[model samples]
Target chain A: MTISFTDAKSLNHDQLEEGTAFAPRFDAHGLITVVTLEDGSNDVLMVAHMNAETLSLTLESGIAHYWSRSRKAIWKKGETSGEMQEVIELRTDCDQDCLVMVVRQTGRGAACHTGRKSCFYRKVIMTDGTASLEDTGLPRLFDPEAVYGG
Target chain B: MTISFTDAKSLNHDQLEEGTAFAPRFDAHGLITVVTLEDGSNDVLMVAHMNAETLSLTLESGIAHYWSRSRKAIWKKGETSGEMQEVIELRTDCDQDCLVMVVRQTGRGAACHTGRKSCFYRKVIMTDGTASLEDTGLPRLFDPEAVYGG
Candidate 1:
């Protein structure tokens, strides 16, 4: 009894729009974009991609899992850092090429490998036609160097 | 002095982490992921992609612009629908491959082609090894057929 999704192209408009079918449309690469947000506050924690296996694991376990394109492996969030994300809600866009997961971040509450609360800790500033970045001053919740080592 | 970004590979730890340089890492297709969120509420409006030109325009004009992969064209969000998103803040992740935009949604406040307030209007439910979607019951702010024509 494992949860599963249907093929997006096979679904009719009613099923796609109003019905209960969960048909996700994966890109040619067999990956779908996943946006993770912190529960309650809804702050975007990170953006990643998920393959079918990782997606199913996330759904079955209520824990966040992502496909690591760079490593060519499946990533179980917080497996190494103890910063797991427990799914509060999972949603998909109109066509289902994208996913949104509202989760209760556990442990140190940092989502970025760099130890930031969120991956996006810097703002882009454009002034006088020149662009630069400014730190948002969000403190790091953990020491990545200590956790992952050099 | 037109704003420009450095090649992602050229950035060192300091340049990538703390420096003011804005070096975005575009994918092989020359696109970067952009996530839009409501300014005050932080509600995720939509997720899209941007090419270099669209990214520059977004920064220069303080308006959201995206690259439509399916259409093979640039998209000025809300151009025909009058749902322009004014950028209040633009953020980049640690490596700069992703962007998060805090925007003031203008016009009807609908960010989805389906006429919904946000692109994600349904929640996914998995019970007894079966997955389905449930409408969040968020009313349409406008009619798509009326706005874009049937």
Candidate 2:
């Protein structure tokens, strides 16, 4: 069955922001940004994008699905690896241009392709007019090579 | 003085993903996605965009700056409402295409234009075959009309 969303074009500012309608304003690429966070820790695991189909699949199956920009296809996350995410809660921002998803990380609890629990493992540091990065010392939970196989 | 970044074009995959270089990969529109979170509660405040100029300004001032897509200009957040955000930490994803900022919401302790502590005040509810939204019961910390002046 095909699922559809309320047309955001028809909603006024107040209705869109304050009302209960689920009209997501997809960007020109037919995608909306999604920020995924681990449910227990509330740590941001990854940031990804989803098209209407993946969004429906996510809501229907209670699993996280995303649109891989580089691959130009629907990505059932953890299909290749064993890091599936169980959706606990899904939220939309006021303007409905972005989404926040709380999920329970399955398998080895890794949420990044680099085998880390979170994609955001490095903090930006600015010193003497130059900016660099410092690792937060988050250790990898799994081996990407063994899981993804080059 | 103009701040510059280590051009992402010069970085290889390993250098960009695993190295310490702060090479942010801006999208085709010369903007990168930013996710802001409250420092203590860790609730997502808002999702925004940042160009090189706003990115530099944010780092230089230790305050949050964003690219206002609607206004087509640099937005010094809280400039109008006194809810300025003092960035506590800035982080980049493994691919450097997205950013996470931990901030202390000043003034009225609100981080949303709607006068709420968070822009993500509603949760998406999928029941049966339909989807809608349910408010999270987060009360507005300030009045928009009195602050912004209708």
Candidate 3:
């Protein structure tokens, strides 16, 4: 099958409307590329799924929204955690089957199942010095309980 | 373009080989879904990425392997943290785009950063009260320091 290509930097890319599942509209289908904010430390402070609606919401609101598996529903960032993710930029890969979201994580903590700061908590192993199972550093500056709860 | 459908229960359905990434292989592109495993406490010890290779490895070794993005390699579960994720059984969604990796987390703490056990450490907003972010009991499990030793 033949597929068309479009450059995200200069394209008709815009905020999708309500009820639009960005994942389906763009045909990105099943791939979500999460960008790490901190250069060396990959702390995930949010975990959002892109099906389309939330994708558009992210683009429009400049915030992150996701599909909560446990809740089996749509979720808006900072809706409860008070930790919102601001969109820095958005990019789609050459194949268009995936999307990359660059955002600045608000609040302090990982954006994953684990309460670290990034979704990439697990480190990768290689021939070189062992990679961090994940970037782990809660330097008081990122303790929500200390800041918010305390 | 039209897409072909396949049986997820079958072995040929987007399986992956377990190990960290060495180099991007043709089969690496087969990863279409992420399977999650959490014990009774809502503790997500680890999250495994399944391409075609690691999926097969899950069946063979009964452990988890995922595509290591940072290291540009493949990784086996507990290969580093010793908190290996033993495969219990694998389940796929209706569309076959993702899989539910029901696994038993054999570890000291969590499979995440911030030294918590499980990728999901806390729950943000439970809109419908359907999901509660069960605290895996605050404690350091896989000490990134002790293991990696920065």
RMSD (Cα, Å) for all candidates, in order, is 1.4, 0.8, 17.9
- TM-score of structure candidate 2: 0.98
True contacts kept of each: 0.87, 0.71, 0.00
iRMS, candidate 1, in Å: value is 1.0
Model 1 chain B: which ten-residue window has the lowest total lDDT?
B1-10
What TM-score does each of the candidates earn? 0.96, 0.98, 0.42
Best by DockQ: 1
Model 2 in CAPRI terms: which quality?
high
Per residue, candidate 2 scores C-alpha lDDT tens digits across A87-146 of 999999999999999999999899999999999999999878999999998899999999
Tens digits of lDDT, candidate 3, B1-150: 111222333423113111122122222356544534464443334443566566556555667777765465667866776877776655432223344455677767455544455443332112232211223245666567787676
Task: List the candidate numbers ranked by TM-score, top first.
Answer: 2, 1, 3
- Let me know the DockQ for model 3: 0.03
What lDDT tens digits, residue by residue, belong to model 2 across residues B1-150? 556889998999999999999999999999999999999777899999999999999999999999999999999999999999999999999999999999999999988889999999999997778999999998999999999987
Which candidate, 1 or 3, would have the higher DockQ against the true structure?
Answer: 1
Best prediction by TM-score: 2
RMSD after Cα superposition, model 2: 0.8
Model 3 spans > 4 angstroms off: A1-48, A51-150, B1-28, B122-137
Off by over 4 Å in 1: none
Docking class of 3: incorrect
Give lDDT tens digits, candidate 3, residues A50-77.
6555654655566777765448676786
